[model samples]
Target chain A: MKFTIQVNEGPYQHQATDSAYLFTKAALEKGHEIFRVFFYHDGVNNGTRLTTPPQDDRNIVKRWSELSAEHDLDLVICVAAAQRRGIVDDGEAERNGKDATNIAPGFRISGLGQLVEGAIQSDRLVVFGD
Target chain B: MSEIKKFMYVNRRAPYGTIYAWESLEVVLIGAAFEQDVSMAFIDDGVYQLTKGQDTTGLEMKNFSPTYSALGDYEVTKIYIEKESLEERGLTLEDLQHLTWEDEDEDWAEKDSIKLVSRAEMAQVFADQDVFFNF
Candidate 1:
C-alpha cells in the first residue's frame, strides 16, 4: 500500500514527529511504499537545518533526511506554514529577502496542494499529529 | 480520468490560542482548487471557530472568522457541525454565522451549508470520507 504521512508538530517537544518517523520506517521495512511525508504547522520546524540536539539524542530531523536518502521519500513542508514558522529553503530565503536559509536536506518547500494531491495519489493518508 | 475522492477537514480545536484552526482553514481553501469532493466537520472546541460575533480586537489577531463565509465561493458548501458537540458546549445553531452557498444549477438560489448532525451521523460522515485532514 502507498502511504502519505502528515506530521503536525515539531521535533523533540512533541512526539508526533518521532511517531511519524518510526511509522514510516516500519512501513518501509514491511515493503510498503511511502508516497510522501507532508509536514504542516509546527511540523515545518522539523525541516530547519539549525536544529542541534545533544549528541546522545535521536536527532529527529537528521533521521528523516537519512531515511529519505535511503528510501527516496518525498519530504514536503507546507510553504505557507513554513514561512510563518521561519523554515526557509535557499530559494525561499532569496525570494523573501531573508539573510539565510536553514532548511534541512532532502526536504522541499511546497504548496498545500501537495498534501491534497498526496491524498488523491496515495492508498492511505495517515496523520500523526497533536 | 481520476475519480473524485471524498475529503473532510476535521476541525477540533478552538479558534484561537493555537494555530491549528487557521492552518486547517488554509489547507481547505487550497484543497478547494483540486476539484475534489470536500466537506468540513466542526466538532469539540472547533465549533467555536464559527461563532457569529467573534472579536479578535483585544487579541490583535487577523480575526479570520469572516473567511468562513467565503467558503461557498470556493464551491465548498458542506459544513457539518456535530449536534452533541454544540449541545455539550451549550451552543445552538443561532450562535454560528449562517453559512450558505449559491447553487448555480439551482439558478443561483442561496442554500444553507451548515448541516447539524448527530454523533452517529457524524460517524457515518467519517466513514464516507476517503481522506480526512484532522486538526
Candidate 2:
C-alpha cells in the first residue's frame, strides 16, 4: 500500500504531527510504501531545526528528521504555509533576504501542488490534523 | 498523464477567527489547476462559509468568502452543502450566496453549482471520492 501523510498542526502544541509521525513509522515498518509526507498549516513547524526540548523529553523534530533519513522519505513543508510560520530554508532565506534558515534536515519547502500530487500518486492520503 | 481522479475538500470550520478557511481555499484554488473532478463539501461550522452578507471590517481580516464565487470560473462546479449542517446552523439556502457556472457545452448556458445534499448523501459523495482534503 502506498501512502501520503499530511500533518496539519505543530509538533508539540498539537498531537497531529506526533500521530502522523507514528503512523508513518508504523506504515513503513509494515512494509508499506510512503510516497510522500506533506506538512501544511502549523505542521510546517515540525521541520524547524531550532526545536529544543528538555533533556528527558522526546525530540519531535529530530525524530521526524531521522525517520525521513532512515526511510529516504520525501518530507515536504508547504512553502506558503512555511513562510507564514517562519519555517525558512536556505533558498528561502536567500530569496527573502533573511539572515538565517531554520529548516531541519531531510525536509524541503514546496507548494500545495505537492499535496495534490501525493494524493494522486498514492493509494491513500491520510491527514493527521486537529 | 490523462488520468482524472475525484478530489474533495472537506470544510468544517467557521470562516473567521481562524486561518483554516482561507488556507483551505488556497489549496482548492491550487488543486483546481490539476483538472481533477473537484468538489467542495461544507459541513458543520463550514456551512457559515457560504452565508451571504458577511462583513469583516472591524476584524481586519481579508474577506475571502467572495472568492468562492470565482470558483466556477476555475472549473470547480461541484459545491456540496450538507443539509443537516445548514439546518443546525439555522441557515437556509436563501441565506447562502448563489453560485453558478457557465456550461460551454450547452452554448454557454448558466447552471447552478450549489448542491444541497443530506448527510447520508454527503457520506455517499465522500465514499465516491478518490481523495479528500479536510480543513
Candidate 3:
C-alpha cells in the first residue's frame, strides 16, 4: 500500500509530528511505499533547518530529515502555510525578499495541489494534528 | 489511467478560533480540481462552520462562511453534517445556510447539498472513503 502522511502541527507543540514520523518509519520498514509527506499549517515548522535541540532530547526535525534522506522521501511543505509562518527555502526567501532561508534538507516548498495529488495517487492519506 | 478515489475531508474544529477551518476549506477548493469523488464531514465543532449569519466585521477577519455556498459550484455537492454535532451545539439544519447545487443528471434542478447523518452512518461513510483528510 502507498501512503501520504500529512503533519499539521508544529514540533514540540503537539504529538502529531512524532506520531507521523513513527508511522512513516513503520510503514517504510513494512515495505510500503510512501508517496509523500506534506506539511501544512503549523506543520511547516517541522521543515525549518535552524531548530537546535539539546543533546538529551529527540530532535524531531532532524529525525524527519534523516528519515527522508534514508528513504528518498518526497517531503513537502505548503508554500502558503510556510510563508504565513516564515518557513522558507533559499528560493522562496530570495523571491520574497527575505534575508535568510531555513528550510531543512530533504524538504521542498510547494502548493496545496500536492496534497490533492497525493490523495489522487496514494492509497491512503493519513493526517496527524490537533 | 488512475482510478478516481473517494476523498473525504473531516472538519472537526470551529471556524475563526483557529486556522484549521479556513485551511481545510482551502484544501477542499484545490482538491475540487482533481474531480475525485469528494465529500466533507462536519463533526464536533465543525458544525459551526456552516451556521448562518456569520459576521466578521467586529473580528477584523475575512468572513469565509459565504464560501461554503460556492462549494456547490465546484462540484462539491456531498456535504455530510453529523446530526449529533448539530444537536450538541443546540443547532439544527435550519440554522445552517441553505446550500444547494444544480444536479446535471436531473436536468439542472437545484437540490439541497447538505445531508444530516447519525454517528453510526458517519462512521460508515468514513469506512467507505479511499482517503481521509482531517483538520
What's the DockQ of model 1? 0.75
Superposed Cα deviation of residue A110, candidate 3 (Å)? 0.5
| Number of clashes recorded per candidate | 0, 0, 0
lDDT of 2: 0.94
What Cα-based lDDT does every candidate model obtain? 0.95, 0.94, 0.93
Question: Tens digit of lDDT per residue, candidate 2, span B1-135?
Answer: 468899999999999978899999999999988899999999999999999999999999898999999999999999999999999978999999999999999998999999999999999999999888999
Q: What C-alpha lDDT, on a 0 to 100 scale, does residue A69 get in candidate 3?
A: 93
- Sort the candidates on DockQ, descending order: 2, 1, 3
- Cα lDDT, model 2, residue B134: 92
Candidate 3 lDDT tens digits, B1-135: 267988899999999989999999999998888889999999999999999999989999999999999999999999999999999999999999989999999999999999999999999989998888888
For candidate 1, chain B by itself scores a TM value of 0.98
| Candidate 3 structure quality by residue, lDDT tens digits, A18-130 | 99999999999999999999999999999998999899999998999999999999999999899999998888988999998998999999999999998888887888987
Model 1: how far is B95 from its true place, Å? 0.5
TM-score of chain A of each: 0.98, 0.98, 0.98
Candidate 3 structure, TM-score to reference: 0.95
lDDT of 2 by residue, A1-130 (tens): 9999999998879988889999999999999999999999899999999988998988999999899999999999999999898999989999899999999999999999999999988899999986
Interface RMSD of each: 1.3, 0.9, 1.3
User: What is the alpha-carbon lDDT for the whole of candidate 1?
Assistant: 0.95
After superposing candidate 3, which stretches have Cα over 4 Å from the reference?
none
